[model samples]
Target: MVSPSPELALHGLVLLGTDTVYAVHMPTFTAPHDFQAVLRVTLDTDTYRTARKRYGTSALFTARPRTLLLKDLQPGATCPADLYFGRFGRDGEPLGEVSITIEETVYVGHPAAEPRTLRYVLFGREQLYLSHVLTRPPDFDQVVTAQLAGEWWASGSGAETPARTVTVPDRPDDLTGRLRPGEQLTADGTQLQVLAEVYLETADLAAGGV
Candidate 1:
């Protein structure tokens, strides 16, 4: 990637350094916040961190990611505070320059992963959730071997769902976690099945109403 020109003005929190990644905890704000917004960086070059979500801000957000390229920038580097926000892999690039008085300096080191926002490899449908985000993708054209815990939710009746861990080894693209009925996950180009799906219906949007 080419160096991020000093002409664009960034518009979010600035890192004192690039030696570490930042975990953002924004206060609950009303609509229009675009909470799932991805954090962009400009330490001589442009890079981005993936937002954990693309919708509501109920979930904790991990913003201000560290890109692999930062390993080269020396400490005390400066960055402008005119960052831009937009859809993932879409538009929202920022530009312009800032006066020395307003520019922020790099105080930390670059995070291990580029696009430094941390992620979870969790699995859930409705009430269920994924355990982690770093869970590696299964090898191509191969069945996935994995372990999952499903005893967290007390959501069953008569025969309450047992709280026991299960082995989900070598199952092709087996996906677990919050998902809608129409959506599906794929492995090795195969569509994964939805063991359990969860969702809510609102006056503005419903499963079929949307």
Candidate 2:
């Protein structure tokens, strides 16, 4: 209903050790009531194309800056480099972009462990939240349709809020990524889950769900 303020900063999570970056946009509009959005992971075209060539294109979808999966990466390894989130609308309209110039990596148990965590920041302020490194390349079957608030908007400046995150398999018990209609998953102080049920309002306007 309202446009995001230009002053708002983009905040989200980056899958540590990979080119995958999850830009946590503001909540989207849902049916009965608005619900939280999911961790929207995006990848550069070259990186995405490489994954398609290595892992097969059957599971992937086409987008300018693609989303999902990184190939031949090992856990705990430093990411290729800082990444950017090129914002887009549900109708595939252009929004704005933000880049993660600085990053700080943190480890839980051992310094060298699968699914390690990292934070993406800019000027000491967190631009990205804590995210994990998958033990192996994520399977396309990992993608699941869940209820989310529709549309992407800027996260107006403020403290980072807890939001929903997609389930990544082969991690810790909590990271196992499973959700019933009402269950929730909490990781690294981040709350994630599937909302009951809702539809994107933009479907009434344009094409594609985004």
Candidate 3:
């Protein structure tokens, strides 16, 4: 039988001079056949001081398409995926669009085979990115028109700057030993969230007599 679904969480901190962006990915597996993806974006100004110390600046910001989420996949599975961000004018008109595409492949074990299963692969991600930038962005949204054709990668192990840690400064004479806190502000006065989910149909192979 298939194992129980696992829980995964990924968090990243980005510093924009006056603002900070926190990207959070949380996945909760409900049923053996069901899944859920959650993404949240939080802006904190209180962390400004820490950000400045780390990034060497204080003013930070996000361009547009404030939030995004993509979800649902077996633990070892991968797949080609496409993502798009669109801007809208004050009048609610389409402004421009930006997109990212990823090639993904997924691997699952075959019960009868003991150590191996099936793999799913696709190539549309690259095409989708190209089409969006070369054609869709210009036709749909101009704000992101300049960002149409580009390659992007989703989550994976790669080189990343080490996370810096800071200590709260304590005063010489404070009996309570409380350290002064920094300011915290929200991004664009709004909290951004994104969620993505994937589910595996394990029995499909057996049903197909594979």
Candidate 4:
């Protein structure tokens, strides 16, 4: 089982140049018993259009050189665009470091069209060398949850909620929880509900961080 600590939390963020796509991971609530992780993303209308013009109509959005900003990146403000993983003793001493390497591909479509399919696969790891100060030998167990939201490149597509209010559960395994990847969580312009739990374990925290 993943050991729980004040510093075991990890945040990740990504930004697309063409559009002001902002993604963040936030630690909503935490306690000795459980913790909550929330991921959110937003796309700028103007920039999204520019991306469509430069990139051809396809199914995926490629990577481009865009300005990435880390806003209010506190312990859990949101997912940090830059991956920062470190092992600190209960006393808060650095035991390791965090780094990331990205591989991306993009597919574009018509001005008024949505790509039939858009897919991006991120593969990498974060390494942490446990120091002797750690209470126990690293057991190689960590739980991380990520959430993603993006605006449709085409306007009036109604693909995303103009504004969404997500209610995260105070407990990790609570039935009423926020939406997760692979899980179909949507608000029918009314009440929000979890359609499914498709969010899988995308990364391993202990052995080879994903």
Candidate 5:
């Protein structure tokens, strides 16, 4: 369950640069120092994503020499820069801490059927599926979508009214709520919907499907 807290996200941004260059977070300066800007990015290392999982690292970088300025930081306005991070400012105030638990993957998927061919994907390959599966009372087939003309990427925060936007492809499928799992719901024959559900085999169940 990835309920993101503003504070931890800030820390994640900071830790992203500790080993090599210092990272900065929402920075405030006094007087003349304001004219100088800082770079939002630093020389990143290969182990970049791995370092993001650590906690307890301070989100506040002490405004060091290694950090460069962008264009003289502005009041009430900031640019995205790295090299540690200047943050200019944060999107929202810190909301508090988040805890995560990791173990073998629990998954939901549909068995392949004729016309659909065999198809299975790692659960929650995209954040959207995770949001649905891990939240209170998960339900599937809850989205309206069509087959895409070609491969596409979904964009946008998963919480908004039009939360998911399908990318444009060579052709597009007509949008329809009637789309069903394993149905070739797209135009180019490249898109299909599959019903993903948590499954239990007979061996895992108590006697007589109890």
Candidate 6:
């Protein structure tokens, strides 16, 4: 009879200028004894989802970049892009040092599947914009504005919200919790009514509602 294949130790290489961006190893939520390793690999070299696997009782190697370029990136803005992944090339060069191991023995319960909260995005005639995704009601003395200010390039695409005078019905007399879909709000002398899903058709932005 043939013996079962021996479980092998995990080994990997995280190359720079490649898609393998981040790597992590942690215990599975359901079974604390079994550990899961995750690798945050991106298609366009952008940080996104993770590649997870269960490796029981085996040595594993993981490496991730020291710095990321898209940490502060926005939809239509440029951020200081700097990358640091330690020394490379030639023999005897140090690539970096990484050690990942699970020490905890507790198994946290699986998280509940909560629905996503939809955001209310408001845009102007050109590329100007404002948006709100209020999950909780504001306090009695709280006053809401258009939030931060930024610019968007596309002619009719989405943009960041700029500072402006935004008010709902009854002004200070009414609370911001009263704001609902189809309700109109005056934003910088412009009347913009909130809707469920607002879609802007353009090649620069996605055709789906923003």
Top candidate, metric lDDT: 2
Predicted structure with the largest TM-score when compared to the true one? 4
lDDT of 6: 0.25
Q: What is the C-alpha lDDT profile of model 5 across 51-102, one tens digit per residue?
A: 3334212232222222233232222222232322222134323322222111
Model 2, range 1-210, lDDT digits (tens) per residue? 122222222222222112332322222122211112123343433553344345331222222223222221123222222222221333332322322222222221111224533221111012223222122222111122222233221233433334323343344422233333454444444344433221112222122121
State how far residue 182 of model 3 sits from its true place (Å).
Answer: 14
Candidate 3 CA-lDDT value: 0.20
Q: Model 4 — TM-score against the truth?
A: 0.24
Question: What's each prediction's TM-score?
Answer: 0.21, 0.23, 0.18, 0.24, 0.19, 0.23
Q: Between candidates 4 and 5, which one is better according to lDDT? A: 5
Compare candidates 4 and 5 on TM-score and give the better one: 4
Tens digit of per-residue lDDT, candidate 6, span 52-124: 1121111122233332222211123121211213212212233234332222211111112233232232323
- Which portions of model 1 miss their true places by more than 4 Å? 1-68, 72-82, 93-132, 138-175, 178-210
Each model's lDDT comes to 0.24, 0.26, 0.20, 0.23, 0.24, 0.25
Q: What is the lDDT for 119 in model 3?
A: 14
lDDT by residue for model 1 (1-210), tens: 112322222222321112122211111111221121112123433332232133222222112222211222223444333333431123434432331121222121111223212232222222222111111222011111122232233332222112121232333222333232333454233233433321111221111100
Candidate 5's TM-score: 0.19
Off by over 4 Å in 3: 1-59, 64-67, 72-96, 100-161, 171-210
lDDT of 4 by residue, 1-210 (tens): 122334433322222222223222211122111122222233323333354346422212212112223232233332212221111111222212222222211111111122211111111111000000001111111122222323212433334322222223232321123233344222222222222221222222222211
- Name the lDDT of candidate 5: 0.24
What ranges in model 4 sit over 4 Å off? 1-10, 26-162, 166-186, 190-210
Worst 10 residues of 2 by lDDT: 118-127
TM-score for predicted model 2 compared with the true structure: 0.23
lDDT of 3 by residue, 1-210 (tens): 122233322111111212222211111122221221111123222333343345332122122323222243233232221111111121222222322121111111112212211111111111100000001100110000001112232223232212211122222211132111122212222211111111111121222211
Q: Mind sharing the TM-score for model 3? A: 0.18
Model 4 lDDT, full chain set: 0.23
